[model samples]
Target chain A: MEQSFLAYLRGRTRNLPSVAVGIGDDAAVLNFPGTPEFPSTPESPATPDSADTPCLQQVACTDQIIDGVDFRSDSQPLASIGYKSIAINLSDIAAMGATPTAALVTLTLPSLNATEIAGEVYEGILEACAEFNVAVAGGDLSTYDGPLAISVTLLGTVTAPWLRTGAKEGDAIFVSGSLGGSLSGRHLRPIPRIELANRLRQHVNVNAAIDVSDGFSLDLDRMLASSRVGAELNIEQIPISDAAHAMSKDSNRSPLEHAWSDGEDFELIFTVDESDAAALEELSADDLSVNVTRVGSVVGRTGLWKRITGSKLERVFPQGYVHGETDE
Target chain B: MEQSFLAYLRGRTRNLPSVAVGIGDDAAVLNFPGTPEFPSTPESPATPDSADTPCLQQVACTDQIIDGVDFRSDSQPLASIGYKSIAINLSDIAAMGATPTAALVTLTLPSLNATEIAGEVYEGILEACAEFNVAVAGGDLSTYDGPLAISVTLLGTVTAPWLRTGAKEGDAIFVSGSLGGSLSGRHLRPIPRIELANRLRQHVNVNAAIDVSDGFSLDLDRMLASSRVGAELNIEQIPISDAAHAMSKDSNRSPLEHAWSDGEDFELIFTVDESDAAALEELSADDLSVNVTRVGSVVGRTGLWKRITGSKLERVFPQGYVHGETDE
Candidate 1:
């Protein structure tokens, strides 16, 4: 179904490549992905339990990426910028254990060759959408007097959503994949753990979850704070990525510090009860399609703690890419 | 149910007025308004035929408003800008003949006093959401090096969507509300005819519809072209707004020209069969809470025509605010 729609969309957007739509109308029509299609009326009702749309539990997330702030427009290609825009929102959906359904994109174009830029950007956007089977249902396109910016609102559904406020004292904290130095361009090609989270939910219960968009320690700290708990981490067990080790050579910070403080490492940080954690261990890393490591355990206290091999457990402060620091 | 949520939201956003959301969670959770409430799981699936959630058909529209282009940040209040952002999106939903369900707002803040600006802006955003009964479910807020930009994606549902391609020959075109000179500041306070369109749908079968976002003549011509027809407008019957007349005093154009050309009136221009047009005539102006006028008819010829009293039918060239004219 989506293949035909993609073909039609490809044909339609040949002239107006920013979005597959007609501005002649006031708004675009959207059918819920995996549900009955559009042109529905009062006499003809969409059916119940259409095998694909099992859970009507809708989840939504929105994020904006700017040209200069989020990425260097001069150095980075427009397509990569567009891909990152959609990817981050999908990552947010994965955090909630939701299967992404559709996206609404809005673009504010810079005062450059605006149409050419929009076409290039949306090329990557449509590519990502087709890859995920997410319909680019609707969007608003406009040229602005300033820098280019794109915001995407992704809608999805889940049988059971994992929130950031359900961690119990005995819950074991886990980090999926590795984290750190995503700013080295891996940030632009985020692999949202949509299938991994879905299959994991089928195996065991997830108490709380969050995507590490803004670094592992900071996001994990946020999850703990929301659940009204603290965590104690095993320093050696932290799955720092190779990028972190590479970054530590140039910067004074250690690889562990980069894992703790560098932002845009799109990975999953979640908590599961001890029994569910034990159940998760039985599945090989290949079974999950990603590496998962036991990082910490929820504690009763209210601050972050880390245990080192030959040193005592010590306090750690929350640090990451802090926003809202305006130059003015 | 929304009342309690509103109260909780109000209490929650006392300090953080930007969007009533937390940055801690990777994404915010959304319960479809009018559907069964949230925390829904696989075992507890949301039911079918919940009265308010009747329509399985989903519609979505997104619009982004920038500071210098759409509105003047210095003269206009941030609250009014916020209100207009959501209002324009709701206007698109209304044009689709759908009841709005939820909104996801994303803000790209400027470098100066970002937090205060976000707080003030969201004050009116929350106000508009409360008035429309649309949930402000989730949003992303970030400070950037450029001017303020707001993009709102509104989700809605309808039994049968009003399309711009359904009009037929001899159908009478009707417009709700007076038009033009919206650039005179009436553009800031857009009154989206959500209830009016709903009531109108009950009264007559609307053959086609388009919102006068750009202008009467331009949008009407676009609608007519999409329906594969032409329109002959009555020059004497053009319902000009007071703002247009006031603007005419200082400009070279007449009030009728302003009615035909100025943008952002946010009025509805629709078509119905001659029989349904007669049915609409029986409705009192008070019944719609806005003035409705028979302004034109779908013609067999393939261009816009204006027929003045005691004059021949004349061609009217399409002219309105043009976008994409960039400096670079």
Candidate 2:
């Protein structure tokens, strides 16, 4: 299916003049000449802004939530559903080291009190949009069978924003806040870290960046792949949420295991040059007010490894999520 | 719910920087800076021969599809559902006299689909994407308990694209092909007029443009509203489709009634100066190979009016297929 779809997509003829990179990439990058404010109507004349740069950079990202997979209707509130819908996309922009600017929401539902459901969903969306200062622009709504679902597309800006590549050998790796065990409350209400990312973009020269959505191990692999480098992690230094610790004992899974495989942490994992690592760590301690720990460093080897209690580093499996990869 | 949600969004924040137009507008406007087509993997940079334009222009539009209201899951294939979802958005870009470049799809579904459903859905998407040569950059997905609904956000570019207010008094209003009574097959598989838009944009200076998604009355009303002009239409001149005529008789609705408010036609309705209109019509007829007719002219009034058989003109209601609105 993926192959067929890709083949079909490759055949379309584009008519636009400023598409830059259209489809078939991790993110779509658009180039709009200068900054233009919103026109009141289609009739309003285009008033292009005179900036130093001829064109502005826009980054867009999208994610999906399913009935049984992403959330259960009975367990999740409509408001939480809406918030998380947009929150997840914002996290993607953060992964790109971009600041989220606005989002468009589309909904599918069954015949219920649409007015009431819209209110609940919008309430949650507005809450997050307000917190992030993202405008809820135009959207599409329709009815469907089965459980309720929401799809959010977030648009953001990047000024020297981090990318998956840009890492070099010997670069030090760090992460914002703690990792692992987010299935507790954090998973339900994960902070986007837009502010943190914005600050980091301003202060640090981040080599590579990715959000922890597909678990630390898998997401780290993506970051490394982009950077054309490998990485090593100290298992002892990995952070685990308090809830993960409590749940791990009963599940026979260690805290490290949860941190490495459990997804939806929404934390920023980034790399910095070795020389700037100490300075970044000190700056993080004093200014960022977040614990910046050195998990490991970029290695010449082209894969991921973890250092356990013993001296030897063991291969780590990516027990994380992959989109559209069905178990055939 | 819509009112409350709008209120919640309004209560948050002052103005932001990245967004030109925030909430409360028809569409969100943004300025993307430094948007270059970089390597997809940073390992495979694109070559210079890529035909895509490296600049960004404006992106504006709206989209919506409902179940029972838009499609029936039992009857509609997943592939068609996905195709129709994006087709509507591309139509909007065409209405603005722009070319579709990138698209963001949002889907809210009810139940879980095996790999088959995913394959079919993506299949439809890639079909549309390939046809338009537009990128499916990013989108969001979520679950709901309602009917299946899909919304798409399309980004496009305009080089001297027509505007709603560009219509001048005495400008001729022209429509592409036949309209009215799209309730049959066209509504389900309406073709987006992006190609026609591009062809006409170069030869004609369109004053104002719109796609007939709603009934001709309402959509025309919108065009008039934006141009701050009025329109006079010859009812007898409306090109009712054969499918519409068939449905009108089957449902006991007047052919004219179905043509006026049946919705989902996806045909381009545009206005041009009287002098340029003649030339455009000739050029479109000969070069574009499409029927371009003079359906009406811009008037001095603030609303829309149609000339009837007795040479009498009546005001158009501009009300179409409202989801829950009842006819008196």
Candidate 3:
């Protein structure tokens, strides 16, 4: 079963030139066009004549989707499970402002109907890879007696990569798309802001960036903690999704609360200088494909806050997704 | 629980300078000292002035261990489960003839007693990382209702990598350490053969390599199929462990069968040019630490054969571990 699945993947990815050694090896070997911009050191310069000097900076990350927790194996389509697993990881690559190159997938399947389910899962994975222009370099497959789980490790290349710790105090906060209420299939069908991030970086300076996986407020808290800054968000200005409004109809929770709390949105939350913010807004207006919204501004204080009514700032508690915390 | 586990890992890996951004971000950033040997093509070379050219060929692989399938979480110690998960990935890196560098672990735990089990698992991961000089760069943690599953993605560096398709018809097949009877504690405590592979590569040209995860015959069959070669094995020359002998006592299967079929040995089986085989054997003689055994020679025929009594050649069937195949 593992062999057949690998053969399918290898047939699909054999055309990629960078994949020097793909499936059927101990590990996949790749040929990266090394960047000469970032030299190791003056004392230890990378001489082309030397046989040991590396020429490319490898960017790698891993993410996973579990059945019942992340998605329902029985209820949800396997293709979405496959797509979301890869998309979430690609979102990380986008967060780094990098161009995704390749990926290695690891799948753990249940004993019954494993092959059929794996085929559907890989179909979704290949579709996503095709959409993102990433090669399915290689992967490992196994079967267990438990529910299915999918984990993907994405590898990419970045020069002058954007980091979460690069934000400045006066930078304006921006999000790539509307947030909140991902349970309405948005979480399963996220477009990992890969191209949007690249285009934005080409036009404007992105000071810091992170993908919202653990809700807007929590992911924002991550960027703030990394940059040692705070934020003041205008609650009314946030781009709440239609799903958020619908989800909030029956509960006491406001759409704003859903926009701030519901996780797995997979949108890019970034900060830029006040001057670049206008340029980004102009770019967004010109190219309406990406919905870039300005929701807040970076503050010097050490905690997240929201402007409710008037100018009163209320401290926003860390209330987004925290794994193993069931008291939501 | 995720935060506390990440904090523990961050504290342990904070001192690694190569880790640019370790944890608490969308992804962990690493600074690989690019090798200068594989220079970029001059036509479109990575300019020193540009900020995007990568300088190193990053080697990455992901492997997984699931409860009930890979191990029984209720019976097996969590530490071994953790250690094996990392060691298997390290084995993949070693098979590439690359040095193990860093790793990102993705863990999916059950809803109950997740924290305590996670701590033990991470302790084992950290211990293995310390032993291998690998940094725990970052990881994702989640909880599910099913059994625990651990997936590790290991990143490494290689200037000139070894591939499974590099073997020629005249190459000699060599395996490190004794084989079979891995179920007798060896499977859970198997060494990754990282250093041994490095030392052997430095001494001899390893044409092709693979780690024995799915049994000796099956993995070798993969190398044979990849290299388009065949093999002639001397059955009596194969080293069978004591546990294999003990297990064969009550069964009709021979100890040699276990040597040929039992999986999870984690030993490296490599093909080297016949000219360098003597050198590797001499190195093993001098070191006494790495047990290098020459059990076969690459043949021109497209099928595996064994030398039986009276010097007769018998075709060997490809039999070993196949996922979900229960007819042992």
For model 3, residues A1-328, the per-residue Cα lDDT tens digits are 2223334434433233333333332123333333243223332354574334433334567777888777897789999899989899889888877767677777787777777777788778878887887666555677777788888888776555667778889999999789888888788889898888778866888888888888888888878887899999876788999999998998689998999888989888999899988877776434735888998999998689987779788997766876566611
TM, chain A, every candidate: 0.82, 0.84, 0.82
Per-residue C-alpha lDDT of model 2 across residues B1-328, encoded as one tens digit per residue: 3434445655653455444444433344443332233212231233454335423335555465656667876887888878887888888778767767678765554445533554576678778888887766655444434555667778766545565656778889888878777756676677888888877866777878878877777777777887788988876787788877888777888887877776888888888877887787567455754677778899988788887658677887775765434211
Model 2, A1-328: lDDT tens digits are 2334434444543434334444433345564432332222243233444333323356777666755668776777888888888888888887767767777776655446655666677778878988887867656555444455566777765644466777789999888777777776777788876777767755778888888887888888878876788988776777777877877888898887888888898888889888778777668444764666778899978888887667777877667766545523
| CAPRI quality band, candidate 2 | acceptable
Whole-structure CA lDDT of model 2: 0.68
Interface RMSD, candidates in the order listed? 18.6, 6.7, 16.8
How well is each residue in B182-290 modelled by candidate 1, as lDDT tens digits? 9888888889888888899789988878888878888888778878899888767989999999999999999999999888988988999999999998998788778
Q: On residues A1-328, what C-alpha lDDT tens digit does candidate 1 reach at each position?
A: 2122223323422221111112111112123332343333563345565545533445667888888888878999889888889888888888877777677777788766776777678778877876776656556666667888888988776554677877889799998988788887699888888877877877888888888876788788878887889998886788899999999999999998999888998888899999989988888878887878998899988678987656667898878875543334
What local distance difference test score does each model get? 0.73, 0.68, 0.73
Per-residue lDDT of candidate 3, residues B1-328 (tens digit): 2233334434433233333333332123333333232233322354564344433344677777888778987878899888888888888888777777667777787768767677788778877877887766556667778888888988776544667776789899988888888887888767998888768756787888888887888788777877888899876778888888988887688998998988988888889888898777777434735788998999888678997777788999767777666411
Which window of 10 residues has the lowest lDDT sum in candidate 2 chain B? B35-44
**Each candidate: RMSD to true structure?**
12.0, 7.0, 10.7
| Per-model TM-score on C-alpha atoms | 0.82, 0.81, 0.82
| Candidate 1 off by > 4 Å | A1-55, A307-313, A325-328, B1-55, B307-313, B325-328
The DockQ of each candidate is 0.20, 0.26, 0.17
The candidate 1 chain B region of ten consecutive residues with least summed lDDT is: B17-26
